[model samples]
Target: MWRRRAAVGVPLQEGKRVLSLLDDDGRGSHLFLLNVAQAGEAGLVGTVLAVEAAAHGHGDAPRFECKVSFDRRGTGWRQSSTFGVRSTNLSGGLPADGFAFVAPNPPPAAASVTITLFDISSGEPGSALRPVLPRSRRSRTRLSATTTAAAAVLLR
Candidate 1:
């Protein structure tokens, strides 16, 4: 059976955070921190963060790593990138003050990837942003595409 794996990261400290990712076999995935969390911060609790996902080839070695960062335009935290089969850290604590996530390499072609800035305090992960969100982006993009296609059809 083809199965999909997922991971959720919660910042326990400034640089340190806990990653709870699921393996394809439905086992507990590996967890570590390149940079330990700092003390006296909001941590992952109720904080906005990003998420990324990717798939490389098939069996092992090409694991997915999610990197989080604050959005551009001084907006909010959002998923910056996803790299295949590499170690990463949420450096600088989810990219405050208009920061970005830097990926070491390009992701796989068949990889499913996304970055989400979520506020867990709302009882829903990735559900507190206003003005713009991933869904909004999709909706707006689809709308624009539809409008363009309609106009083209009418012109034809």
Candidate 2:
């Protein structure tokens, strides 16, 4: 099963927030408002959000989420996913053929999501997954941080 957490009504005021995943056994994923909608339960398209291994889990398990948006009239299908993979795996575990939902257009409004991996084994998030719930909300944006970078990062 997949573990998901979300952040809505994000202030698109030009900044960043850090989404930390403290585990690998699970992952955090999101769908753009538009992408979540359906035009008859067919998903309207046959595309999947491409989640790079780098966007899956950190360390050996890589934990991350995919973001997408849907639109009324069913004209949009945008897709975007984020996660991290084990630093040792140059291939990122997931094959290059992997795919996910893509948002065709920018969100009509301000919204963001963050999924956290919980240790089903411990009935809570694992050691790698920390800062559970009420995800961090910052006013600054920064580039993706590699394993070498600090655990904290800014999101936009």
Candidate 3:
């Protein structure tokens, strides 16, 4: 069975946010979002609004694609980023479980974001995989601390 966790609505600065997708056996991949601030003082910064995964194709050769939507913070702009794992290579074979997160050519500004995990093989929306909020104050604190540390590192 495959299992995954997501951390959504994370607040980040003008840097990168790294998200890890973990399975039941503690195996998974990482997705990253790079945030870029506006130039000078006139343009609006770019921000990520949500991330979702869905199955592409409908037959035996279906593949997985991760979609990320951007929020220009009210700048009347719409941008999307996609990541995918091809089901077949030149050798006409399926590769092992693999994933990647490619940053947009021009990074967007920092903003709140949501991350999701889905299984492309199942061909069903994995709503059950949505992350549940930490129930305890300690858990929230720990998550915050970790996120802060990660942000610091990425901003450097």
Could you say which candidate leads in lDDT? 3
Clashing residue pairs, candidate 3?
Answer: 46-109
Model 3 C-alpha lDDT versus the unseen true structure: 0.36
Q: Which candidate do you rate higher for TM-score, 2 or 3? A: 3
Off by over 4 Å in 3: 1-19, 22-63, 81-83, 86-115, 127-138, 141-156
Instruction: Encode model 2's per-residue lDDT on 62-95: one tens digit a residue.
Output: 3322323333334443334443221222244433
After superposition, candidate 1 runs with Cα above 4 Å error: 1-13, 34-62, 67-79, 85-156
- Model 3, 27: alpha-carbon shift in Å? 11
Comparing 1 with 3 on lDDT, the higher-scoring candidate is 3
Q: lDDT tens string, model 3, 1-156?
A: 333233445543355453444332345443323344444443324332112243232223433344444445556655555554343322422232343333333436542233333435456543122333346732653233222111111211
List the candidates' TM-scores in order.
Answer: 0.27, 0.27, 0.35
* Candidate 1 residue lDDT tens string, 60-87: 2423333343332334333444333233
